[model samples]
Target: MFEWLRVFWQGRIFFLARGDQLPRFLNQALKDGVVLYHTQKSERGMRAQIKLADFRCLRRAARQTHTRVHIVAKYGWPFVAARWWRRKGLLTGFVIIAMALTVLSQLVLSISVSGNRNVISSDVLERAEKLGLKTWAYSKNLDLNQIAKALQEQLPDAAWIGIERNGTDIKIKISEKIRPSIPKEAGNLVASHAGLIKEIMVIQGNPQVHEGETVRAGQVLITQALNPSLPSKTTAPNSAVNNAVARGFVRGRVWYSAEKQILLVEDKVEESGRVATGWGIKFGSRVIMVTTQNSPFEQTNKEVTSPFLQPWRNWSFPVEVIRVNYKELHNVHLERSVVEARQLAEQAARTEVQSKITPMVQIVEENVKVLPSNSGAERVRVEVETYEDLAVYANP
Candidate 1:
């Protein structure tokens, strides 16, 4: 520790000396209270390292002994810092970057949620944010164990939870509870939507309705109770049927409708082709703008591009160059014909229907009609009929 302190303060230098009286020069230098280390002697000359401040004193000793001294190398932090200080711009940039990184290391930049299926990712992130585990939060203030316990208590469906951090990114990993299958006695199959009963196939229950019958929502299409007195060749004498949970598919035709409206006049934004460019330097959270002129357009779209400084393998500088571009935009009013408005409204109605329907449902028929509106907007109504499974399991 003391040797390191000496190097840090006084620095260290390696020098070569060549003279017949080199031995005398070393003796005199030691006598004058100058320390020498890592001394080596070769056929050509001698090399040794001494404190940079002591080297000045050693020069006088070398002159008294008629020996020539030549500086070979310099080592230690002080010497390296001095070399960098000579280049003012490089030194300023490095200092700014170092300070920025030191500050950024304490703040969080991103939070990611993974390993969730039944529980929504947004729900997990919302909970984390409420607990002060979010982007821009102080990393050192977070307690992983406390946060994990809180999440477990809040989210009963989560079987396991883990919080981990790497640099500015935080990751929340969760293992959701696997819901157990419905017990044979606990659940019953029921209609998920009101529709016509196209077909009924009972796998573990008695059919309650016939094909082509219209059923309302929440009505059961199959009964869980089995008939005991019904005689069958497959059943033994005195054997009774058990009341088990119903399991089967009840496919039906379900009708859905969506309405969309489009205005006869609309405003559309178009690029004006006017662009301006500027450059800036970003030091972590602080950005210094180098451009002198303000943007010329009232409405503009801005884009930024930044480049990283990576000088060596596995090492990179924190400083970056930022380039910005601003593009002008103008809003123009457009008039739409009734036919064009109807087409756009129909397209929007179809999209709305697609969002409402699930992947399991197959659309079988569609009907579209354009209606007159008092608001001067073209209204398009779309009706879709689909053949889909209406069976949904529910606890008895």
Candidate 2:
């Protein structure tokens, strides 16, 4: 008991000495002034507890005496502390890896865009990136309202865009707007819009435009005049045969445009990042406040959220933590005197022109025409060209 109490902090080790030179090893340990407790003799040799500091001295003595020494047991705080010290680097690395995983789990890792038929998924992803939602972005900092609004502005053809977050994945859903179609009436086929003609498949008519050539709107695409090279192919001046309708479809790159005026100056209140919190309790519309002074900022955007409210048939937790977040706000005046207004107007015009596009139209080119402005805004016209079949008919 006394030896254990004395060596508790310092530590002690029990070792076995085995060899024909056991007596010489013990005598050598004594000569080195090493103390051994619980000494016993066995068939192999001897077993005893030596002070940890003296154990090394005993090992040197045994080596000199040609005896083998094996550790039997270890006890006390020094051994425990030494064992922990040796593995400190491994423990530290484990803690760091755990913390890193926890932080990364709260961020978006994968993004998926779905429910889009006409709009490209990559285009939607690009617009979402502009709205601060992307891979590796902090999921909690994202605002669904802002992302949806940005997508709407960027893709006017999309009727709605929904955003959903699940763990480290963000999924965006889109629904495109359906536009009204034009009523078709049969007559002489003519060019509906100015386009670069790509192909002409005529069953029975004169082809005015060739492949890889530009044509204007209202131009005769498949004229009733069978031989267009002739000065007058019609035998009758005003007969059904002379005014026979064109019979083929003309595929070309047709362009459609829309114009809108953009304001030069924009005014709004912007929110500053600084925020303050206030604690209060709401019991069935009765309020109890812990602090009357909520924020130090002069201008603030205020919001109240109740996290502890009971939703089971309005049954209540009488006391709950009501957090009021006050975000600092500042009045902002913005002017787009440069090309910003023109760019904005062009985006708006593109959105508006989405409704005018016909079926089988594949968009190929997009351009903007900035008209001269003397007023407080700029009038920008955006044109979208598409590859489509222009076979709309007119009176022969």
Candidate 3:
């Protein structure tokens, strides 16, 4: 109604009124050249708003009718209402477009495979497609349980499979199965090396050995016993009694050796380098330059991206980014005297040797040799001796 009045007034006319007298106000406004009328009334009184294009004629008529005393003053639409309509008109199209896009985006465009080890992502996607996952399809239509079962059937190597929908994306999680090794035959596994018994457990065979006993490679810890006291006749032996079995556990010391070379020089040198970029783009091994200028540093590099091509529908696309950086550097030298060089070399060698030995192994001895090299530099060689408590398991 107010919109109609604005059109009628055409930026002309005026009106005023209070509650309980809006009818009378309209009558007065009509006579005074206020062509259109709008009224909002409450307990306080009535509000009659009119356009100003014909205000003079309407005012004159109102005065003649003795309605001037009720006329408050000329005014436009309330500030709150005017601003609301203005904003509504401005944002209506944008709001509609946003809502439509949001609805359209609810489609499960594709199934994305994530956290997969053995199963290929493409295979997972193909299985999802068979399970009703597809482009421009509603996410609610997807049956996650059915999809998971289909994926498992397609990828038997996967031990675990699950499907989920997050927003517009469908995720397929796959876990690969790890094969269990078959246990060796009764006596096939023996102590690989010699060691004193530290622990013992007997599962399937009779334990011939006890804890604290020393054992060697090929030594049996437990033996299968058919009869403990029965004596066999010379003519015939019981087949069951002949089939006694044994099992054992043993830990043995294994020898290992490592060698390291150290170069002694008057000065030790080191070099260091950086790259920054704005937007991301890539093709093959090369990345397109998105930045306006080359990096200020002497070292800079760019790489390209190779994007995957869709077989059927060509909708969504992605790009890869690659980057490499180079540096121009000169070595900064630190001079070391002969005495300092010898100490540093020895310390370095000791650390290197210790890293190669296990914590369980005790260092029995160490030998260090420092000699002048033909290159006019000192050479350091160190040998370390260690011992390990190789323990074995015996069953009783």
Candidate 4:
């Protein structure tokens, strides 16, 4: 390694020396302190490498010895640099690009969140940004522990939160708090809503009601107790009943109602054919706007386009050209039909009912009604009756 580095720093040249006095020339060159290496005798002449600076002295020695010398090759950084110096502009551009990349590597470009279920990813990212973990933030300026503590304070529901960095990408990992399980021996199953019992399957404890029985909200459908044996009138009954955890599924028919209203008249916007185009240049986080400020239209839809420098590669330049296009828009009053409005209202009603239904519930029957409205708005009402497991655990 040291020899190779030495050769690279002090450029070397390969040359061929011919004639009977080649030996004398070599001796003379050595006497003058010219380093010669890798000397080999060939059929035509002797080939060897000497310091580039010593090549001149070798020519003099070859002339005195009556020997012909010819340069075979040149090698080392100095020669390579000289060759590159011819294309100065390209070299300068490459150097500038390298320096820019070095600076950009320290700045954060994007942030991502993972390992989160109940917590929203955007919420976590927003909190992180507030804590100095946002895009373009210097990596050295951030403290992972401090950011984690801040996030934990804001999201108390998270069991653990961690921040990691990979080049310009920042990753946030979260572990949500685990809810404690309900004890099987300390709760009773009860009806969640008013319904008629359609099926009762007791898995633990004792059953309180049978199928086809009417039950109301908060009514106990299954008891967390052991059944007591029947006692005669003369015999004394047991004072205590074994009250354990009740675990069972009680399916019942439950009803739900949803309503939605739609306006008969509304304003709609339509784009006029006219469009204006403008552009800007973004340097790092700052944008320099170019073109006229005054727009031709009072209302316009604006679109900004900034394409990546290298969309196919993992790394990209921070600089980009932004093009903004504005399209004119005009509003017009439109009258909607009652049938069309009712269809929209019905869709809204069904969405409302679906949002309330749980995984255990199954829809058994549905009914839709269009209400007679004195107001200008049209209203649609939907009634859905479902059969679902009404087993809700409650502390005994």
Query: Which candidate tops TM-score?
Result: 4
| lDDT (10s digit) by residue, model 3, range 1-396 | 988566544542333443344566567666555555556655655555454545555555454445532455534445444566789866788789999889877887666777766467877776677777877888776677877866664553454577777777777776554322223323323443455555565544566556667666546555555544565553235344444444333333333333333444545333344344444465545556565335555434443323344334864345554333333343556656767777777787777777655443446667787765655455677777644323222221
Give each model's whole-structure lDDT.
Answer: 0.79, 0.77, 0.54, 0.79
The alpha-carbon deviation from the true structure for residue 124 of candidate 4, after best TM-score superposition, in angstroms, is 1.6
Clash number for each model? 1, 0, 25, 1
Which tens-of-lDDT digit does each residue in 187-283 have in candidate 2? 3466666788998888666777789988876666665643444335546553444455567667778778999998788788889798888889877
Each candidate structure's TM-score, on Cα atoms with residue i matched to residue i, is 0.41, 0.36, 0.31, 0.44
* Span of ten consecutive residues with least summed lDDT in model 3: 387-396
Question: RMSD in angstroms, all models?
Answer: 18.2, 16.4, 16.6, 17.5
Per-residue lDDT tens digits for candidate 4, residues 255-348, read 8889999888988898878899877887878877787444678999888787545445786677778877888999978687988889999999
Runs off by more than 4 Å, candidate 3: 1-261, 266-270, 273-280, 292-318, 323-328, 332-334, 359-375, 385-396
Estimate candidate 4's alpha-carbon lDDT, on a 0 to 1 scale.
0.79
Off by over 4 Å in 2: 1-267, 291-295, 307-320, 343-362, 385-396
